[model samples]
Target: MGEDDDGGREVYGKMRAAAALRQIPRPPPTTFQEDLMEHLPAAIYTLLSCWTRFYQIGKNNHVVWDEAHFGKFGSYYLRREFYFDVHPPLGKMLVGLVGLLSGYNGHFEFKSGDEYKEDVPYVAMRVMLATFGVLMVPLAWYTAKELGFSNRAAHLTTIMVLCDVAWLCISRFILLDSMLLFFTVLTVFCLTRFHTERHDPFSPDWWVWLTFTGISIGCVASVKWVGLFVTALVGVYTLEDLWEKFGDLRMRKRDYINHWLARGLMLIGMPLFIYMMSFKLHFIILNHSGPGDAQMSSLFQANLEGNDFSKNPLEVAYGSKITLKNMGFGGGLLHSHVQTYPVGSQQQQVTCYHYKDDNNNWRVEKPWTLPKVDDAGEIEFLKHGDIVRLQHTPTNRNLHSHNVVAPVSKLNNEVSCYGNATAGDAGDHWQVEIVDDLVFGKREKVPRVRSLTTKLRFRHVLSSCYLVAPNSVLPPWGFKQIEVSCDKQNNPSDPHSHWNVESHWNGRLPVGETKFYKSPFLRDFWHLNVAMMTSNNALVPDADKEDILASSPTDWPWMHLGLRMCGWGDNQTKYYLIGNPAVWWSSTLSLGICVIVIAVYLARMQRGYRDWGVGEWDHFLYVCKIAGLGWFFQYVPFLIMGRVTYIHHYLPTLYFAVLMVGHLFDHFVFKSRRLKDTTKWVIFGIATGIVIGVFWWFRGVAFGIDGPIKEHWGLLWRKSWNIYESH
Candidate 1:
């Protein structure tokens, strides 16, 4: 009886093992037709993408919205003229390359709403940038597949990306948005591919994908600062992966360390190297001095071709005409304009300007001297602790500060060009206190002031305050320049209070040699990055000013606003930047649905209910985490940012939400065992049909609306949209 029972139990165990093996999924036998069918979806998406992106891309022959700014930057690149902007150089460099390839001469000034000249290759440039937008569709399809979605879900992802009117419209212009979106999608694609190769760690394919992911990250970040949001997503995924590897008991300690090292090298080190390389190329190409020369260091500007700083005298003497540059990062030249502050002091505005002009030049004179007085006395070289009056060369007004509060920095005294050179009082007298030089340390005795080398501070004689120029910007009354104030706190370490003679002119002193003004690459790199960040931060929306094109972050997911890309004249071609309603609304709805489903699954698991097998559960969690977390990481930062945002800013974030829609549909409808295959195909057909229909209806907004926008009714799905002239 015992032997018979054992035989039965053994047979039952064998039956259970066979059932488990059957549960594991397997791919069908491959054939030429099957292989072709597998790639046909992405290929079809790519062809469709080309038509949509390139169709009528050149229909508008005028500069549209931001095309004015970005296209001008491209011209600056082609002319090899140095210019400064809030973004990194990679995207603009590509723009210049496209212009070069199109035989553009970089001669046309891309002013806003200006018509393109016959010789200008604006069409070719637009088509080249639109290529980035076109590639996004196929990349999305493959990204969905790498994330372990079904073919139906991959098709859905491609359709949503391809049909988005906002992405299509922005790509049709010569702007950085297309490049930013392309690299953003490419980063995610490479990340998913790397995640799939995790089962075989340290394999060639794994390293290749990881390297590509890092390269993509660098490219994305080099396009815009917002790319850091996607990079943060990669960081979170890596941390989770490393933590899982650490928990594996079967893994050797050496192997785990190797994993960390590989990730560190590929993700951190490689991206940094690539980012720095872009800046290096930027510096190499933009070697000539241009409008932005004053934004850089005195030593840096001396190297530029058009700048005459190298011809300036090395030493500063009494009556020397000089431009005082604030030594702080992102600081500007000491400038005084004809306009006066409305509230504070009501004197001529003493501010910091980023452009070189005669207004920025000041003459260093003895406090006791009268205006235009030729002193027959000995030529004395200016030294530390010299009491001098900085007379504005153009206006002849002395640099003056008083007890009145500054307009911007209330705690500091207001600085202004108060009285004429001969009529200034004790307030105009500033004690020249020498700070340590960049090349030379503090001397034991009084050190003679040297151009582009000595750092000095101008202390108010009456108020005992230090002259300062922080990153604070003045209002329009001050010509939107940086605010200059007198700080009450005499902090010696404060860089804002440090100033150096940028351009010195004295007949007595010798010219500065080129070697004396050489600056290091790393220093210049750090300086430019800080400057970019400073200018970008200053772009906060003003309460007193109304920007019609700006939109709140809350308006993004729902498509509550649409931007007019050009004038609404009946004869002019108009483009409205808005997303496809069907795609946007459905994708946004999926984001909320995803959170609820994940919460329910977690609660069920806590109660010991099994809705999915172990393998199936892992796959579900992986897909959801990628889609859900990617959307969260990209979207949340915009909510807290104070900078002015637009509808186009959300394009990168939209890609992830679209992925969530695809994944949720695949999980519940397309790949569900409870649903018949026919039902899944029908659902897919409805979804595809709705997206296409909506895209077709709104296609005029992207392809360029010809007639009066008021005639194009029903396009304003959202009440807040300014697409129509009445609105």
Candidate 2:
């Protein structure tokens, strides 16, 4: 009976997909309307191809690695689980489908330091993302069309995104960054439909508008948290919708608000609900592990607040709360019962029965966990602060990091035994705590210790939550200490700030490893594109330190790049020149294009109209050309000449360029419907003089010693650029 149902479902799914495929026109893989990929300038294509390859096999799934710590498909799969598994499931599903189609569902273990040789899944994932990449042409084209750009401008926009190395690199990767670009651009396109739609709620386009808007937003959030930024952009559109859709007809504000509310409920609300549901059901599937402990803690507190999980043990035990908080970082508290710390009490520390130590310097020792948990099993909680200990293996073994080979190589006491060829005693480098078995019984809140004395008790686990310690796999950034003790009796302020931590290693635990980036979505590559007097820009000294001293566990978005292949360290070798580098010089170049749009708009805007040439076509074009010079300067250097992504030096070049673009646009729009050529030239001269002459005069501040234009700057560019240099 079950087999029959399964077969029926499979047939139905294929039928649905086939129908979807049939509904759309399948043009041969040919270029239409001057695409970025197909119709791009050859130089642009070459750059994009190189970047796409970088993104495809650069940082995420296709990373270069030391022979001891590399895993390809397994690493990819583990990253999905360790990180949030929202939209990547589709990509994973595609991978699984490709695997099944190729009839290699089982593992074909490779020799040491070998790469996976499968081409089908690679081709499938890359082609799928590539197809989306190609789709970007139409999407950007339609966006320009929505904005009412001329055939020339709209077509150019398509070329820009297509030729863009950022877009190309993302396309080559097997993750959600490119997908996110697709969804966001798609949302903007759908929003254009709303913008162009008339005021009438009864119009046929209303339903279609709502459908596209809602689904696009839904899918946007499904890709990653950054979707919220687009969602906000949508709300901005909603406000503008009143001005665009209703403005032409002179509809009252009330009518505009009411009509949009109705459409918004259908479009915005429904899709958001669906996107959230994806997470909820997934949490239900992954019922055990440390999250259960958190859920129980929340449930226990909820019981105190009136709602108890005891009523339906199934509901209580079955699922975690669907919150972004879960995806963020939160590792429970730490206590020492066996005298792990000074002035410690065993009873106060023994909130949970088991405590395992993954720290090298030995903060806490084990019996660190409870009994094991099965896939669907869950550990129960008696009350808040019930104090459970860890006792489980992680579903995300990829993040388990490397199996420890030499415990002697292990700094301090931390160890993950890399067993011999036999797989026996395979090292204990990492310890995963399961919430299910060790024990969850009620306990009294005590007064001896502040932890137990508190009204709120927590499910403390022995595993190192990112909140407690960073992964030891990557290079260490800034430093921190857990136990900073101050004289409480003499201090009246926060202790951590004033605590005199002995600089020696005597009492401090070994510095835990900072987690290596497991996905392309999160990378610690902040390109310091500082703007200098609009003439030059420079990268910051700590460009490689993406989030070294980040405030929280999640701030280290090392895993945020998700699964991109855009390289590990953000390159910054391009901003040494005085003028603008090329667009590919840095990811920050996207801001440069934005500057161009606003410049064109300001130079000829008619109050709130979309027409770029509303007041004066030639003048607007002139301003646009100047603005284009900035981009030309920006891109030409990077493109024709080989350079890299550096923002600080590039910023000075960009700053004045941006202001000129902006002021030129604003001046033309606000100054008048028609102005004299003399007046235009005067304004242009003033803008140019203040930007250029002033920069040249105070060149030191604007373009430091080794800035783009600096003739022979000192050691400014050579500081803090390498990962191996000790601070």
The most accurate candidate by lDDT is 1
Query: What is the C-alpha lDDT profile of model 2 across 483-511, one tens digit per residue?
Result: 21111122122211111100112111223
Please provide, for model 1 over 412-462, each residue's C-alpha lDDT reduced to its tens digit, 9 standing for 90 to 100.
999999788668788899999998776667743436988888889999999
> What lDDT would candidate 2 get against the real structure?
0.33
lDDT assessment of candidate 1:
0.88
| Distance from true location, Cα of 713 in model 1, Å | 3.3
Local lDDT at 166 for model 1: 90
Clashes of each: 0, 75
